[model samples]
Every structure is written in structure tokens, then in C-alpha cells.
Target: MKFKDYLHFLSYAKSLEELWSAHTEQMANFGFDKLIYGCTRFRTATSLGDPEDFVILTNHSQDYVDGFLRNGLYFHAPMLKWALHHEGAASWRLIGQMMQNETLSAEERRVYEFNARLGVTVGFTVSFTSVSERSKGAISLCASSGQTQDEIDAIWDEHGQDLLLMNNIAHLKILSLPYTAPNRVLTKRQREALEWVGDGKTTQDIALLMGLTSATVEKHLRLAREALSVETTAQAVLKASLHNQMFVMEA
Candidate 1:
């Protein structure tokens, strides 16, 4: 697809599913058949916050994701380390250089070996620039199996700027949309309670507004807290707002 056409589609996308589907297809056209995009707003010096809070989008196989993300292999990925420290596109040739120099740690080697076994060795990684110290976003574009790093690099030479621009746009658009893991989804009443809390409403006030008893309002608040994995009503409200879950208009 033309670059302008993709940008138009991206600008109008209203949901993560729609955005990700189009993104994966677009990347595949550039020989990157497998892609993993991840972002975290709660990063710290030691951690990327809770896994459940990450904005993760991918088109990789389930097995790959299970090993790379669910099994925590991403923590030791060499590209992840690179992404954390820098911005802009990088070649997977760096992984080979690290191997040749014997610079990889044991854990990092384990991740490399796993990817090599799965034909995930040839690819490029893009680290997006962020203004906030605690926020980071990146993507791994794994080339189709049998493609050499040289060929992938050539593709980058020809289309790198366009590819990078598309990914940056995708990342920004994703952050603007609302997303929550299935287990973190709040019920309608739970959302209502949090919205009221955000608006500085007391339990009795929310009860009157929603036509429910104070006890019922408290129950909804408690459930919202649990769903958001927060300890108190204030934290619940903050978490819900971050996920764009409260006071959203219905389509």
C-alpha cells in the first residue's frame, strides 16, 4: 500500500485490533512476517511495571509469544536491552556482533539461541523516542525465514525512513486509543463508580446519582479496585483513567 493510504487508514482507526491488523499486514509487505510491538508507561529503574499493564501488539505465532513474552524471555532479549537505552532503528546484525565478541551474558545467549531455533534471527528493531523517563515504546520486525541479514539490511536501505515513520505513527495512535486486558475490564457499574469517584463524588452521592443504595455503590467501587489491581478507590480511579476506561462515550 502507498504510504499516504496507510496513514489515512491509521488516522481513522478506532480500535487496537483494527490498527494492529493493518500494521502487521503492512510490515509483512516489507518482508517482516513477524512483528512484536510493546510499550509500558510505568517503567522504572528496575522493572517495566506489571506485565498486565503493558500495551502489547503482535502478529507472531502463539508459541513465539509464549516463550518470548509470557515466559519472560523478553527480559533477557538483546534487542530489548538496546531498545531501553536508545532511540531510532537498529540492525539485528548487532546480535551477531555481540556473539562474535562473546559479549552476551548467559541469559541473553539463551534468548538468542531460542530465537535462532525459531528462525527469528534476521530482523530490525525500532525504539521510539519518549519525553517521559518512565515511558518507552519499541517494535521488533522479524524478517521471513530464509532471508539473510544482508537482504534485510538492503530492504532497510531502500525503505527504512518510510518504515520508521509508519511505526512511529502506529505507536502514537495506539497510545491514543483505550486498551485493557480482558481480565482487567471493568463492568458497566464498576466503571460508573470509578467515574463518580473521579468526579469527587462520595459513596452516598454516587448512590443517589445511580439510583443504587450506598452499600451497592461501595460494592461497585471495591470491585473496580479489584479489577484494576489497585489497593484503594483513588488508585482505582487513576488506573481506570490511564486505561481510558472511565467516562468513555458509547459507540
Candidate 2:
């Protein structure tokens, strides 16, 4: 499809349902049988212990998806981990197994084989502007079998850039809407702390500048992470930057 058609279609994408509906047709046009775009809300790096972030899964067999969730497959899912920070588009050379070099683990192989047995192989994954370079949202398109890396790259080379741009626009527009979380607003100190981190300041440096202890600086950052509603210090910095909550310090 041409860029004009993409723009025309994207105008109708306000909510996840609308986005998925458009993608269903879009994927079919590109000749695929299954697709899914989902996110996980993590309170900490170790725990996906809460209700997962909003997930909009479609086009896959119900049994396939059910098995994925029941087995906790994501922990070893390489593409899922890669999407946490990298943006743009990419395709695995073969079944998700192609990543089996140093990039994957024994457990990752076990889980992937679980899917291979079910006939789902190879994938193309792209992110929709994550909350942090370490963590954010991702969308993935999977092929049942017999997909080439070149073909995948061709798809990305054709639509990947546009998809990235559109997802960014969609994310900003969503955050700007009235349904924003109440705790999004950070105290001046918290914002200051986070902003400094964004600027590459160390805890000790920020502490020296703010007349606080390294431990005290850590406290402010902890609060900042809570207010930002993201997990990980890296994600906090990224979120603050996304929301314009990151601060600037004078030379």
C-alpha cells in the first residue's frame, strides 16, 4: 500500500480495538494468518506478578495463546525481551530458533520448541515507543512457517518506518487524552532528580548538587519511579523524558 493509504487508514486509529481491526486487515493484505500486539505492566524487573499490561491479542489459535500464557513462555521469549528497548523493525532469520546463538538460552530453546511443535515459527517484531529504552510497549507479527529474512526485511523496509512513526503518534495522542493516571504529576524534587538522571548524572553528583545524601538521592528517585508508574531506574528516566518530567541542570 502507498503512504497516502496508510495515512488515511491511521486516522481511524484512536483506541486499541480500532488499531487491531485495522491491523487484522493489514496483515491479511500482506498475507499472514496470525498477529498480536500486547504489553505487560511490570511493577519490578523480576515480577510480571500483577495483571499484565493491556494485551490485545488476535489472529492466533486460542489454544496456542492459552498454552503460551499457561506455560509463562515470555520469560524466555527473545523477541519480547528485545522489544523492551530497540525500536524500528526486525525479523528473525528462521523460526524464533534462529536466535539460538549466544542470544538465547537453553530455557529459551525449550519454550520456542514448544511453539515450533504448534507450527508457529519466525517473527517480525517492532516497538511502539517504549516507556524506557529498557522497557516499553511492543507489537509483533508472526508467520506460521516458510518466511525469509529478506522478505521480512522487505516488509519492514517498506512499512517498518511508517509503523514506528505511527505508533509514536498513537502513543503521544493516547497519553495526552483525559484518562491520564492521577499520580503522573511528580513533585519538583522528584522531577529534578529524574531529569538529572536523564542528563547522565550519577546519584552522588545529583546528591552533591541537591545538598542531599546518595541515599537521599536514591529515595527521591524511588519516589520518582513510583510517580512515573514504571519499573526500573532506567525506565523511570525514560518515562520522565517522555512526559517532559526530566530536569535540566546548569553548568
Candidate 3:
């Protein structure tokens, strides 16, 4: 698809799944058949927050994801390290250079070897510019198996700017959509209670608004806190707002 046409499609994407499906197909057209995109708003100096809170979209196999993310291999990924501290696109050749220079630790080498076994050897990582100190976003575009770094680099050399822009636009669009973490989706009632709370309603006020008893209002608030994994209703309101789950329009 043409660049302008793709931009228009991305801007109108109404959900993460729809946006990701189109994005993966576009990347595949450029020889990158595997893609992993991740964003976190809870990053800290020492960590990227709970994995559950991360917005991760990928087309990689479950096995690769199980090991790379579920097993915590991302903490030791060399390119992820670079992405944390830098912005813009970077070649996977840096991994080779790190190995040649013996700068890779044992754990990092283990991640490398694991990728090698899975044929996830060559790729480019695009680290997006963070909007805040506690936010980070990035995407890794892995070339199809049997493709070499040299060939991938040539492709990048010609069309890297366009690819980078598309990924950035996609990232921004994702942040605008509602995202609920796994096992943390708030029910309609839970969301309504939180929205009322956000609007400065007390328990009795919310009960009147929703035609429920004050006790039931408290129950909904309590469940909202639990679902968001927060300790209090105020925290639940903030977390829900951050994920764009409160007062959202129905589809």
C-alpha cells in the first residue's frame, strides 16, 4: 500500500487487534514476518513495571513469546537494553558486535542462543520517543528466516524512514485506544461505578445514579479495586482512567 494510504488507515483504527493485524501485514511486505510491539506507562528506573500492565502485540509463536516474555528473557535481551537508553532504529548487527567484543553476559548470550534456535536472528528494533520519564515504547521487526543482516540492512537503507514513521503512528494510535490488562477487564457495572467516583460521587450518590443500594455500590467499588489490582477505590479510578476504561463510549 502507498504510504499516505497506510497513514489514513492507521489513523482510523478503532481497536488494537485491527491495527495490529494491518501492521503485521505491512511489515511482512517488507520481509519482516515477525513483529513484537510493546509499550509500558509504568516504567521505573530498574524495571518496566508488571508484565501484565504492558501493551504487547506480536505475531511470534506462543513458544517464542512464552520464553521471551513469560520467562523474563526480555530483561536480558541486548537490543532491549539498547532500546531502553536510545531512540530511533537500530540494526541487529550490534548484537554480533557485542558478541565479538565479548561484552555479552551469560544471560544475554542465552537469549541470543534461544533466538538463534528459533531462527529469530536478524531484525531491526525501533525505539519510540518516550512521552514521559516513566513511559517507553518500542517494536522489533524480525526478518523472515534465512534472511541475512546484510540484506535486511539494504532494505532498511532504502525504506527505513517510511517504516519508522508507520510504527510511530501506530504506537500513538494504540495509546489512544482502551486497553485492559489480562484478567483485569472491568465489567460494565464496575466501570460505571468508577466513572461516577471519578466524577466526585459518593457511595450513596453512585447508588442513586445506578439504582443500586449503597451496599451494592460499595461492592462494585471493592470489585473494581480488586480487578485493577489496586488497594483503594481512588487508585482503581486512576488505573481505569489510565487504561481508558472509564466513561468510554459503547461501540
Name the runs in model 3 displaced over 4 angstroms. Answer: none
Stretches off by above 4 angstroms in model 2 are: 41-43, 94-103, 132-135, 144-146, 166-251
Q: Give the whole-model CA lDDT for all candidates, comma-separated.
A: 0.92, 0.62, 0.94
Model 1 Cα lDDT, one tens digit per residue, 20-115: 999999999999999999998889999999999888898888999999999999999999999999999999999999999999999999999999
- Cα displacement (Å) at residue 129, model 2: 2.3
TM-score of each: 0.97, 0.58, 0.98
lDDT tens digits, residue span 1-251, model 3: 78899999999999988999999999999999999999998899888988888889999999999999999999899999999999999999999999999999999999999999999999999999999998999999999988999999999999999999999999999999999889788989999999999999999999999999999999998998888888999989877887889878888
The CA-based lDDT of model 2 is what? Answer: 0.62
TM-score, predicted candidate 3 vs. hidden true structure? 0.98
RMSD of 3: 0.9
Pairs that clash in candidate 2: 41-53, 130-136, 195-247
Best by lDDT: 3
Best by TM-score: 3
By TM-score, the candidates rank as 3, 1, 2
